[model samples]
Target: MYILIRYAALSGKRTATLFPDTPVAVACSLLFKFVLNVFYGTIVVENEHYIPKNGEPVIVCSNHVNSLTDALLLVTSVSSKKRNFLRLTAKDSQFGRKTFSSWLIENAGTLPIQRRKEHGDQADNSTTMDKLLTALSEGDAICLFPEGMSRFHPTMAPLKTGVARIVSDVLTRNRDNPEFAVTLLTCSLTYVHRWSFRSDVLVSFNPPLKLTVKDTPSLISTPDKPVDFEAIKSLTTFMHAQLSSNTIDSPSWDLVRVAKTAARIYVPLGTRMRLGDWVRVVARFVEGLAKPVEGTGAGTGGEGVAIERQGMKRTAYQDQLNALGLKDDRIRQSITLSRIKILWRLFLRICQTCLFLAIAAPGLFLWVPVFATTTYKSEQLKRSGPVWDTHDEVAQTKLVYGLASGIFVWLTAIILTTPIFGLGLFFTIWFVPAWMWLTLRWTEDLIAAFRAAVALYRLLWVSKADLKRLRETREDLHGRVMNVATEVLGLPKDPEAEFLVVEGEEGDDQPSRWAKHQRGRTRGGWDSALRYFSIRRRRKRDWNETLRWFDATEFPKE
Candidate 1:
């Protein structure tokens, strides 16, 4: 144990000192990359070219959303062969804890800031500042969450002045050095479903902003006048403006949720919208609603009342569906299903579900403990903690506890199996984690397929009258939402026309030989399995195509 501790300390020191292209840094990056990839189903990095390649000081400023995940994402995503590791500033208490977390932080190249007086003194602050300046002077990349605290807010909090101060100090000290240059790069992290397992994350990096002596001359303070209040304030305001523009922020998530629901129906059925695009559309809609119209009293009072009424109506509709024993998927199918193909699709789904269930049995048993612990702990936290009181805290507890439980369970399994495996313990431990991850992914897919099948069955077998009513209600809701979207977003009357475009010619609709083979395959009695896999691939391809079209035509280039 003593030797292990000493080795950990040595490893931490090496990790801290290693350059980006070094074996240690490369290995750490790969480890973090794998972990993040497993944690998120999809991670889309926008404007990756914006990351500066040449050896020059760069500060990456991002909004704090997910606690440790935010920092990890930034570190792993920004890769460079010329530069060393991206240094980060973390709370001093994290380092002082003398636990596994401290070891992790030290190895991750985190510069600790004193938060509590008891944990860190004046000297510690000075030391941290000096280290930051030294790192900047050496042309290393530094990442800091200017908001200082990670919260579950839809928007960024008012940024603290620490980042601005660091920049100013670095500039002031390096003013005499002719080669001194630093750039501020703003990054935004948007999660489709933050707390949900296998959710998508979008990381966007804005163009780097270079600060010259001419930009903020007040930062050039003399020895007698060390504090440059004006420079600090100006720099902070500038950073906030740049960061906020890149980030999506709203006063209320409830309003945003309402807008998102309304926006969903505006798009074509089976068309998958990018999460980032959906967020921007909702934010813009809310902004338009909040604007004071000349003839109409449609500012805060009118818009707020409208959204509240819409929320209540949606609740009522959900309750009505619940009374009919229909869930979201069932309602969706009921609304979107074509009358002609419904029976055929339902038959196909039934066959597919049987095959899916047969394959999913092993995964179901393997991942049950993970799911049970996560669900139970999440519910417990929601009920007992402050997570229930505020939107910011809603998923925070669940994410924390869920991650802890997963690690603990995996470790426990490894330990228990070690006695039996003995010499093969290492291999068993490695295989188990991979198996667990696969089990989780399989279970999720299985559950989704089962739910879709059940929804189709409900549409066909039970409550035809209720299904018809639900479809009518959905139509009404869609019409209302379209009207609002048309007025606010200036969308064309036929929004589907805007999204759907011919790839080649109107007559070129025939499927290729490979496509036909994929559609009609029954080898090893897995025709249904093949079809399910094809559907998944098709959906992903369609979604990517939709995003590409939007980027090309709908959204303006940055």
Candidate 2:
């Protein structure tokens, strides 16, 4: 399945390269996407017209919310014929052509990235930065998921330093060239029925912006204050600004709709399902196969009745298999959130372990002490109040006292002249065990930070699983509704859309979904329920909901 996607991307690249400008490439992407949707279903491109028609060395930075398909989605959103090819930044794991990821090599000329320790795993066997910098210098337009990897979240996640780094490098290198002002544009993808028909997924584009180094606070700093911390702040703001202007008001499911539309209406895969004004509604025929075959009066009371839901348009040709199928294979259930999160978890675990072990190795252990303590202290010295600020004359006195004691240790160790005294003499020879102290502190901080990260990831994992189950219930409910849509009151032929409005309206009127979420989380088989009720009777809402999130799907899916 993944191979087919890579195949389409590669073919699209070859097809798009024939044309000039980025638009053709986008067009080719669209065509290729259109092609893939034949079997994949439709991917509706919403607000895509917002993508800029022209720009200098532009970047289409979108929230990397899904799979590699985001790359092609960008291409097609603009045009299929433009040739200003786009190169994507991919992790180093996809480094070589070793069968499984071989197609990745063929399709996306994905620039392999191996991180340089910036606080993850001090693991840098390969310099992905050099490669990324090299690519920037190559003058090709590219896109990066500043978050580093596709993440699961209701809204756009936090910006990472990478985007800032890329912008800084380009601006710094091309300081004098007007053309060097790299245009960074944000593309906010709002998925509708992400994998089904009539998706209202939107790909809104914001005006391109520039990241200039001249905007920094004094590329240099004053005594005691040693870093250009504000510069990072400015760059971070730019990332938010890049997409802020383009984001539209919508919920999670909206994006699914858009993605599904684009997915289906897209071009064919291989050469088997090309488009020309019409598609084999054979794909469209299954539009609601889940419905009864004939007013509940056919085989098995009409349950055996088959339907094929592809785009309603009939194509020039139909595959015999599709024709013979008991159902319309065009539209399909979207890849569930559970599945996507599972994959994300797998990817994250692998990557995190690689990061952890690499950073934890002996080579790093040698410096861990330095990074942990001394460096952190140095930084603290820069940020904290002056040592004398406590006006605690006591601190200065301690400093003096400790200094005198150090000198006394040297004198005493010298006088003792024993091997143990020699060791004391050696330590006292230097200042405050300073050499080993920094790295030790740094290691502790690193461990704490990783602990926080692991904690955060655990929390996220629980949330991911819980959310998936909740969504499954909702989707299952949706499935049930569809199976009985025509039969239900207040429902449409496609009631999911209607359910959306109901959900939205309820969202507005509810007394804080968070509150409801907490109550919902209590596990129960009557006893647990009784316990929850007892606890609820004594606790007020404020303190209760703050720490408890047992609602929305119970205990989270850890």
Candidate 3:
């Protein structure tokens, strides 16, 4: 079964004449599911309703963070009922590849985009533009990374003029067709651990910006007009604002880390935050910490403390976190548990991990070669060039090489055992991928559990004194952050208060209306009931309000 599945995936035979209209859509969906479920863990999508399902052509624009992974996630996760034909724009160089990757690209229906850096001054995108225009005219969906390239940048790179130009050209040509409306949809992809296997990914789709001929009267005055450069520039700025609002656009990677750590620490106990909510909190931190403006005079003895200065202080706090080799969650756990209890928990966790390891031993043994091959190949790719050096690129290279190596391992195993086992090899081959999956699952859990346990053990034993000091430091830092948030971001006095509205999750507790409702109306047993109660007691804040500070239009003057 595994071999057949692999064969089907690797086959070069074409199916549908149009890209996504055939089995390719199903293949893409399955591929996405495999990646998100097997390669990664806990995929969350927010504002999925924003994905237009009315069959109107839409251009999906996203920040390029995870190389090809970004494109895959955007195309797969954001779907329209009327149109699942999502074509992606890739660099022209990638389209010419004759390898397995090129086959995958062909099946995916990707349009080749020209980049000046690669093609130099002679780069031509006329053919690609024609195809894109035709697709959009037929109400197809197109995904493009406005950044042109993918990297682990602290914030989005300056968006290319291509997105704006595409929008302009599409709207200008279709101005007379009142039925033709091209919408620009912004998708924000946030990976909790970019390069790590089984890391979490949050895909947040912002509300679509509908561009009708009527909406852009200035740019689409005449349908016969050539590409409007001024319209493209204006629209690009607008695109920047839309993307910035939907993404965590920190000024630097260090500041991004600082913001994330601050958010992790700031989230109140018993409150669960998905990556979407967490990013909004982080965005608030970035807005507060990125700029060096006068702090509210109330915090620092008549003189105001600039948020940028506060950010500097927090940098040291983040450094402390790194030095202690503990996450804010671990610190919080330590603060609540006695040292003896911590030791007990650590011992149990270790024993639990050992049990998992024992169960997963056979799978791990079989897959070790595949993993090693992928690692070696990915490392080589990292040393290849600057383009392949980013964490996401390495991950993507691993995905490619890992798939290739796994097939090689399987074929070799079958060849070796077929003579002795004969027909039995077919039955046993299924166990290969199955066990490998089990091992991968075990490994993911093992790493997370063991890391926390080790960190806890170290806090209780190795760096015993640092625990208390770190706790105090974290508390002090948390308090200072709250003050700055309240003063600088104009947050409420109790910003972390229950009933605070946030991104993804919103709405305050309905104390007045709860008495009018009955639990019998709900389904899904105790779990659903508990979830209902949890949400009822939960406080949410409109994270959009705080995140607006990072909007490109509102960027503070230096």
Top-scoring candidate (lDDT): 3
Backbone clash total, candidate 1:
0
Per-residue C-alpha lDDT of model 3 across residues 82-198, encoded as one tens digit per residue: 344466677767766777656666665566767788779999979878877887887767777787777756677898887887887787788887656788988777765565555
**Model 2 lDDT at residue 221:** 38
**lDDT of predicted model 3:** 0.61
Clashes of each: 0, 85, 7
Residue 338 alpha-carbon offset, candidate 3, angstroms: 2.9
- RMSD to the true structure for each prediction, in A, is 9.5, 26.0, 8.5
**How much is 289 displaced in model 1, in angstroms?**
4.0
TM-score per prediction, in order, is: 0.72, 0.37, 0.79
Using TM-score as the measure, name the better of candidate 1 and candidate 2: 1
TM-score computed on alpha carbons, candidate 3 = 0.79
Point out where model 3 deviates above 4 Å: 1-29, 80-82, 221-230, 268-271, 294-315, 387-392, 410-426, 462-465, 490-558
- Estimate, for each residue in 1-558, the C-alpha lDDT of model 1 and write its tens digit: 000000112123322332233344344455566656665655656566667764578888888777767777777676544343577766765665655445545554555576644554453578867877887777767788888777665667898898888888888888776446679888877765665656567677766788765555677666776766876887788777766654456555654555545555566422233434444455555554444443336553445446633543354454454455444445665556675577777677667667756766775665666667767765664566353133233244444445555677678777778888756578766777767665554555555555555655555665667667777777777666676666545655665554342332212223222111011111112323463342121223222122111111111111
By the TM-score metric, which is better: model 1 or model 3? 3
- Cα RMSD for candidate 2? 26.0
Candidates ranked by TM-score: 3, 1, 2
Q: For this target, which candidate reaches the highest TM-score against the unseen true structure?
A: 3
Model 1: lDDT of residue 269: 29
Range of the 10 consecutive residues with the lowest summed lDDT in candidate 2 = 549-558
Worst 10 residues of 1 by lDDT: 1-10
- What does candidate 2's lDDT look like per residue over 240-281, in tens digits? 765633332213322323222222323212112111111111
**Higher-scoring candidate on lDDT, 1 or 2:** 1
